[model samples]
Target: MKDLLIGVDIGGTTIKHGIITKEGTLIDKWEIDTDITNHGENVPYDIWNSIKTRLTDLQIGYDRLIGIGVGAPGFIDPISGVVAIAVNIGWHDFNLKEILENLSNLPVYIDNDANIAALGENWKGSGQLVSNMLAVTLGTGVGGGIIANGQILTGTNGTGAEIGHMTVIPENGYHCNCGRTGCLETIASATGFVRVAKQWIEEGKADSLKVRLQEQGNLSTKDIFEIARSGDESTNQLIEYILDHLGLALANLAVTLNPAKIVIGGGVSKAGEQLSKPLQKSFDKYALPRAKEACEIVIADLGNDAGIFGGAFLALQKS
Candidate 1:
């Protein structure tokens, strides 16, 4: 019926693909491992080929497709359709739009992963109907997407609302992948949480976390939260520090954007209310009273599918 859209979200290890209705209903979805063996030079061809095979297997005619939308992690230039850099995916100056368009002979659009996620959440998840909203993802690294006056704000070079790179700690902070020191990502991300916990253990501030780390040979944000629940004062303190910095960063964004909702997603958010309650306490400490009172913090409902929905939204809007 020409009412279907193809949505592709490229991650470091997996590439997620979806067929969604024009109204944002995901009809079918699947994932494929990312082949990064050769600097990702063959990734584009693989993605397009996979989509065609899936369509044939599903008995869907090419006439039913309208366009394709893609979301990836990087400094995406939506205007140029070139991914300037995606460290995790090994794509630099990748002309994503032209390749997809030429291969499929269909309209293709792309945006930053976080930005598409924000659009998806606002359109169908917790931030629905809000013209002003913010979506923050706390995973291996932090990601931010901002919506203002009903439009996604992709400023010049598509770096707008990149809260992860914000300099929350100006001195002696852990190094970020972006080559900066003391970024919020070095404090609020899962990687950041582990780094801080390791530092605390070395400083004799945490005993349970150190023991757990040794037993497991590694640590995660989940482990930290679990330990805190078991009455480990050190782990609790570490959680507080991470959340407090996350809160402070969100607060600064809240005061500036004055968004009606702040939707938190990603791996750390899996902790749920255990993460939100204390985070709200820390946010109230720094946010302006009006901003704090106006914004409602909530968890994302769509989980990982946000990107697929968001990618469909991009196709609907741009093509």
Candidate 2:
């Protein structure tokens, strides 16, 4: 029997799992609600149970599975498989690997969710062609992962590529969830996009978006991009504002890390070229010429599947 790999991506609201072959083919995928209640104490058991049930349904014995890899949102101690903190999921210094292994009786590997996503992209997605790459996720917040010389550069504490928390605006910047001011996430994430648009409306900038905001009570990053695509000058300016900061952040990463490709993912990337075109312009303006020439900004292809694929890759490596 061919050995199978199990990949698990644990999010705030849901847990995604995949059954993959050693050669990187996804055989099956499914999801389950994350029971974050009680400090997420049941999450590990839930995952173990789900995997066991799936294996039973497939009539595959436990020995046929090579290992399990988990991508979780938090500051994880990759070597120890312990999550130091995960505010969204209410995990604190949790020994995730030990618990999951106890239940599945298989070797388990775990890492930060963003890091795993980067690995997934590096292994099979947009960054696959490059030896050095970065994956930046722009969602409610910004998350980043770095691949250096074909390896995940997880820092000593597994928090190395935390690009979102990098301070971009030291003066009069909005507060970040990390209890800091002026993080890149403050101005470049989907929430930041909406915050800027609302600020413009409050400052008496009248445009088509004002009517939409008044009607909808809120605007998504998508809504802003759609307005910009239709030649709305004010919305276009808003997009430029967002891209300016995003570009600056990415350029800094480019000059520092000299990654061959920077793959953009998450909800905000759905803006597509509306985000990339202006973003590339800003990046080129700020990046060192040599670094800028070496790196290309591209969108992620795997979407949500990146994490699962990355998890499976990790399992395959460790097994």
lDDT of 2: 0.91
lDDT of 2 at 108: 96
Tell me the TM-score of each prediction against the true structure: 0.97, 0.97
- In candidate 2, list every pair of residues with a backbone clash: none
Model 2 misplaced stretches (Cα beyond 4 Å): none
| lDDT tens digits, residue span 169-251, model 1 | 88887898889899999989988999999999999899999999899999988999999999888788889888898899899
Expressed as tens digits, the lDDT of each residue in 32-145 for candidate 2 is 999999999999999999988988898888777889989999899999999999998899999999999889888999999998999888888988748899999999899998
Return model 2's CA RMSD, one decimal: 1.1
Q: Per-residue lDDT for 29 in model 1?
A: 97
Q: What is the C-alpha RMSD of each candidate to the true structure, in Å?
A: 1.2, 1.1
